[model samples]
Target: MAVKEFKLPDVGEGVAEGELVSWLVAPGDRVEEDQPVAEVETDKALVEVPSSYDGTVEELFVEEGEMVPVGDVIISFRVDEEGEADETGEADAVDEAGDETAAAAESEAAADEASAEPGTADAEPEPAAADAEPETPSGRTFAPPSARRLARELGVDLAAVDGSGPGGRVTEADVRAHAAGDAGGADAGGAESDEAPAPTPTDVGSGDRKSAVRKRGEDGSGDAPEPAGRDTTLATPATRKLARDRGVDVDDVPTDETRDGEAFVTGEHVRAYADALESAAATASTGGGSAEPTPEPEPVDVGADAEPAASDAAGDAEPAPAGATEAGGDETSAPESGDETVPYRGVRRTIGKQMERSKFTAPHVTHHDTAEVDALVAAREELKPTAAERGVKLTYMPFVMKAIVAGLKEHPYLNSELREDEEEIVLKKEYNLGIAVATDAGLMVPVVDDVDEKGLFELAEEVRDLAARARDRSLKPAEMKGGTFTVTNFGAVGGEFATPIINYPETAILGLGAIEERPVVRERDGTSEVVPAPTLPLSLSIDHRVVDGAVAAEFANTVMEHLETPLLLLNE
Candidate 1:
């Protein structure tokens, strides 16, 4: 047998290191080549790492929650050589030697023995009995250090979980499963402390001391007394804090989830418990019997009525500094109880670093303008039916994209990246537009490649599809890379213009505003006439080091010309 070490590879995009999130395989388990064994987080994205060779997992070098650099050994495997005795052969040999000596007892112990590793399946019956000593029928437990740590963090009772690892050892999957079940119902109803027993001795750890001592009747048949604060609650540190913030006790929060003889509590339980308390308090104050439930909003056509929703999902604005003043110029103060602190890690940290680098490195100069896009609006109305028939939900974004591509054809500088290290400007021949999507987690930009070669209908479908995927966090790392230019539509949410930070390495970013109708003066037959016209707002931010003010103005003007005369886009 040969032992081989598996190192973490550079997944792509120059990722330096990744946080090990979870392992799909356990030690002693056989894995096939190219099978995913672990999930790693890099650049705020989760990606699975596959095995390089087919072998039995010997050990995991890095524990979950730890970060490992690329090229570092993360795991080791035991490879089987030709003509070598495999685990099955070893087990068979042991069974043949034992003959019928231990055969009768084996069937009765089958359930408990099933948890043993494959290599130990045919070991002497005495050793198998020795392995079962740690796990008692009364619910004692044995788990690896990593699994124990995760159980504590998740507030899970390891004793309640059935071990699936070698030698009856509890694994991470068991802890996660226990936690998920608890979150669903362990704290379902808001049961008061008076209704349930006080907190008692739980399997979490020896943090709180129990004072009660059990005493039996003279016959020694009475049930033992339960300990104080014995309720099983599964919650993270953050969830516990949230419960405290809302003045709810985790123990009092009732849940429905009870698996493996233990109940689990979640933040949702705490919130529901608190809300119920508040509602009861309000009803008592007003002398009302009951309060009515909050009404839900009526549904509307999202495409037309939900323009702001589009913008909210398109930009990730830098979070305001703590204690900053409000819009009314009133200085904000910390909460009386205490300031709620949130760690700026993951996507937020990545965004902050990128913003700092781009702002400091690139000298930004923004040019703002408005275009009379009455023709563009009219053209979209005319093509809307045909687009729908083609199974495309066409939006103004496609028109803007086509117009931007046309404008880039005239002003190639905006469609290029500036490499400061090489002191050279690299103009991209193929247009790949990066569209900024605002997700609940953070801002993501999914690139639409070869935009210059696609029609408006295709561009619309791709933009819509990418935005949906980005919001759901399903976009791959490759889909987000290789952008020549970027477009951010703040107007979808209601902004007229914004000085958008350039996507680093890219030279310019165009910010599109909401289309609005306003009064305008027009000349006809040498006479001036006042009429309402559709106006589209535009904000172009460029890298001033590479693009001049005249060039920026020309580019914006060309974009405006395309929008004002929609038919001109066909010629491009």
Candidate 2:
């Protein structure tokens, strides 16, 4: 039989290495070609790695919970061969290696036998010395040295974790699982003895994600018993610092992660538990012995189940949340008990980097104006019936989009991007308008191409479909790419006149604020009259490095003019 190596393949863009979350096959297991043998997690998404050849698994080169780079051999398979006639130098070397392996095995067997002999208490010093290694439990826990070091740093007990690696050996992921308190630790009696076999591909199920360990007690105020001779809380170093800074006891923090029927804590759990406690205290102080029980804090949906949007372009900075700590925010104080630190990962991380780059790279200047959208609103309402007849729900965004495109045609600089490296400004002829939709995860901008070519009905239908898909996170990466400009209707979320950072490489972004009826002065027969008008708030942010204030103001005026008289859109 010839042993063949299987290497990890490139999954997608920007993924150089991936963490091996779990192994599906083990030694001696027969695998089919294209059969999934492991689950890997990259920054983009979680994916399964399939085997390249059908054969009996000989060994797994890498353990689970470790990061493996692309093209690294991860598993080996013993393949059936018809003939083997070669007895060359390579074969002799392999034979010698095999002989050495057998000799070592014999030595180990002899030591085991010597140690087990009756009345041989001090006969096997070498075996005794080998057994004295820290984190090396007797029965199993066959983790690599890297895993042991990590366990020591995290204060995790290696013996407690259920290994998911080959031969039931503990892996890096197992140590991480132990630290997070969701390793499904062995029963107290089974921890130090008995080999815990790794679950096979058929036995293991999908969706086995690690969860945050929960705090102790229902209300989180009861005293929790500590684990014997060990730290009860299982938290990262940052979480411990957060707890100490907030003057909260780490032991009081609860988590959803539990093992051996004991709750383990994480940074998120600590923040949540402390927030609940503060809210309870505030209610008590306000009630002042009224005998009404304090109400529980309403749970915040963390968007755990939200689908991810399309990946951002390379070098695009991740976006940050509004009012997030800027570069000069206070650095000394511990985070408040009620303040939760949301890690910048996935979409949020991309947004933060993107926003920071845009804010710093482009000299942004924003101008605020209002447009009387009474005509546009009436036009949409008039067309609503026709749109509904075709099974489409139309909104004001389509009218605004058409108006913006008309305005862009009248003044083309807003539809252009400045190529600083090339020392030239390229004005895009095609109108690929990006529509920003707020999703459960974050803000996603899905582009609608050739907007200028499509009619109002087409624009309305396409816009409606794109927005729905964006919120559901079903948008493809291509649908979010090649935008000439972006439009953010913050008005839909009850905001007005935000100085939106430009979606970098693009010259400008137009923000539409809440449209409401307000008093306006109008000229009637050369006399001023005060009347209520439906006005839409507009904030235009432009790259000052390319477009001047005069150009920006005129562009804003033209957009408002089209918005007020939307029927003029047909003139184009």
Candidate 3:
């Protein structure tokens, strides 16, 4: 058979090597062209490598988990050929000529046996039988010896049992089945149940020792078992030391709650557990060293009028209430109320890297503006019933996106990129608006491609799909990239104003703050009366190198005007 070697190819971006995660096929398996042969992982992402040619696998040169460089031979395939190897001294003499020739001979021999029929190959030569004792190359006893003994004892038919043992030698089970007269009905189920019993708890410990003994006997080496009671929970070396110092059980802390299946424990969870323990200890000490303290009486349910009077009295107090802390403390420490540290991986890691790159690369300049969305709010209220009938829950984001698209159309410079080399600025023709979605996996900005073409309803649908995919990590790299501008909604979290960092290379990002009911002067017949209008605070950060103060201000003004007159966005 003709053999062809397949080498690893360079995937992309000048990657030198990749870890072979798994092989989809094995030796002797026939593979088709372009079929996935193996999965590989690089530093950036995981990718599947497909087979180059259609052929039967003759050899596997590299094992899974091996780091293979580009252009390195990984696998070899065999195609049906005309001639067999010459069974003469010529081939042997040529093979013994060099060390590489010896390796090739061994590989060829292995490949031959791997694709060989039964009772073939010199490497696995016949063993010695009891009668005529034909000695095997490994100097081991053959299965025929055991089969003869078993056949005589069980009174089985020698010809009835199919010989699958080495060199077509019959095994003891085969002889037993032959003698049973019902060889076809030998009860394969019963035979399986007669297998070695499951190791007991004591046997498990002994099995470990036995395994060590076998290993030592085989290779004369091993590592010792870890200390008893040491938690197996994954934590950083520094965090483990902190846990030990604080006398905390790392296993009891639930840092993985925020991370789903990720096996990582955080320092914050350790600290919180320690705090809880300290609090419990102090409470116990205060209660005359008792482990259990007296329970406080449940509050009596007051009538509605009485409850209002009590709340009014409490609201009138000058000093801050018990357990209440200053707002500044919330930023540094855990929200005195409740806080959590999500593992910095997955989408969170992506967000962190993108933000870090954006902030460092782009010279951000933020311009703040407020929009009186009184008419927009009125229009939304009017459309609410119709929107409900259409089975779509209308939100401010769609309106804001529509308005932002309108603004971008007016000032196209804002919807462009700054060149990395600081040579030239390329204004993009397409407007791909990326909405920063805050999910369980932190912030993920998924782009809405060609936003200017999509209607408000269509944009809402795309936004929903993007948000869902972003949360599930099913978004493609292209979906997250090539955004001309970004929008982060801090309004969901009740923030009034925030200067969002430009999502780098892109010229600017817009932050939508909480829409609140604020008093506004409404012009009525040349006079004005105070009225509660829905007002939104917006913060726009642009790359100072590309967009100047005037351009940013004009963009902000245009966006504000669109939001002020909601129908203008619909018309545009």
Candidate 4:
């Protein structure tokens, strides 16, 4: 049999190392190609690594909780053929060496070993020391080094009699199972250990010492501990400093009693204390004491350009010219200027970088259109009750998606992306529309694959599932990639119209605004009547370098027309 070493792959942009959070398969377990072997945690996200080949796991090079650098062998597999080893190794070595030429092969191997075993370096020193003994806590023995370290970290006594590893040796798996059982209250002994400490009663009438005093003596007490000072009261460091500088006694600041070990003191407590102190001072000032001193306002200095203009009479300088005064006011009212700081991590950061690259590389243009969707609204209201009864809540988004798909069929250029470096444009035949979903963490665009092939109901179901997963942060990396075009619904947040930034690499992004009832003039033969119609405001942001302004406007108008009629979308 051939042993194939699987090195950790580069999952995202410039990720150096990833922590092995979980192992899906143990040594000797059979795995299929594309099956998840381990879950790894990078700086940005947690991702599952899949097996590249079908084989039996011969050895694990890394242990959970240990971090391994990219290009390090994490696991070895026993494969069916020996001939394929040379070819696989050469290709894998080339792929791993990309963008990481400085890392030596031996260093890579050492990283792999470290990933397979946590604290491997620290485990060797004790074996060489003559007087060193195995420091297994009284009760548990026969545990592997990894298991022993895990137990110590988790506060588990290793002397317990259960073992699940080969030859009755305790493993990390066993420790984890025990921890799970303890958490679930499945063990009565473990539950007893979790009980609260009993209270001690003080002796009343007798001259006997308290149990605490006796316990303190038994514990070998030295000098008495210092009493905590008034700094324990509720207030931020800034607030405390301000009070101290103003000669305010913090002890006089009344605060509500908090539970022992609580991490925070409420802001209400500080405000109440401040209000009480202010009231007392006001009363003292009103009761014939010296009045509160008035503070002087700081003076402003205008620049030379903003100085008073020369007057004809040379006396008043023409009252500093109206424009100079206005200019000074504008400078004072100007918003605080600073760099817009954003974390270069997670989905939002990735999106920001991609957009920056796209905008700088490709020229952009935008188009706007309005659609009167009175019939579409009527159709949706007619279907809403039936859809609800069938456990589906129909929204305007699904209708808009259908209209967009129809428009793409007629004007396929909107679904194409340009490669500036290659000097070529790619026209995608398949319709994979990415629906931009906003979550608390960031924005994620999960593609609704093969949108042209799927029916409206199927599209709606897929959109719902992708949106829910995006919100919960359960979406995989693959779900957010490979999109021909993108759609973002700003209507949900009550926006009338907005120009959404184009999702990078994709040529364009369609923005949907709120559907409002607006007055429309309906003409019948020779007369016209004012009627309320459901109207939608839409904006399309496109790369002007790839597409012209007219083409962008045409595509948007096509989408709007299809949405307004609704029947055109169905037939298409």
lDDT of 4 by residue, 347-460 (tens): 555667777887787677778878999888988888788778877778887788878877777777788988767989888898888998888757778998888777666777
Order the candidates by TM-score, highest first — what do you get? Answer: 1, 2, 4, 3
lDDT of 2 by residue, 379-441 (tens): 888989999999878888878888888878877989999998999999999999999888765
TM-score of 4: 0.49
Residue 89 of candidate 1: its Cα lDDT?
Answer: 23
- Candidate 2 error regions (>4 Å): 1-339
Q: Which ten residues in a row have the lowest lDDT in candidate 1?
A: 204-213
Number of the top-ranking candidate, with lDDT as the measure: 1
Candidate 1 per-residue C-alpha lDDT over 50-135 given as tens digits, one digit per residue, 9 for 90 to 100: 99999766556566655566776677666665743322222232232343436314643433332232322233443333344332
The Cα error of candidate 3 at residue 32, in Å, is 12
- After superposition, which runs of candidate 1 have C-alpha atoms over 4 Å from their true positions? 1-5, 22-32, 53-64, 73-146, 150-346, 523-531
lDDT of 3 by residue, 1-572 (tens): 34556788876455676666677765445788898888765433456788887766544545465566677566765544345353211222223222244434564663333322122223221111111221121222223323433442233434345767755555777666554666442333444222222211111111001100011001111111111232457655445644554445566554422223344554444544444344333333345343344232122221111111112232221111111122211112233235653334434455678789988888888999899998888988887787778776777888998888888888888988767677878878888898988766567788998887877777777898888877765566567777888999998898888879888878989999999998888899999899988899999999888889999999999999999998898675
Q: Give candidate 2's error at residue 72 in angstroms.
A: 7.0
Error of 4 at 561 (Å): 1.3
For each of the candidates, give the backbone clash count. 18, 23, 1, 9
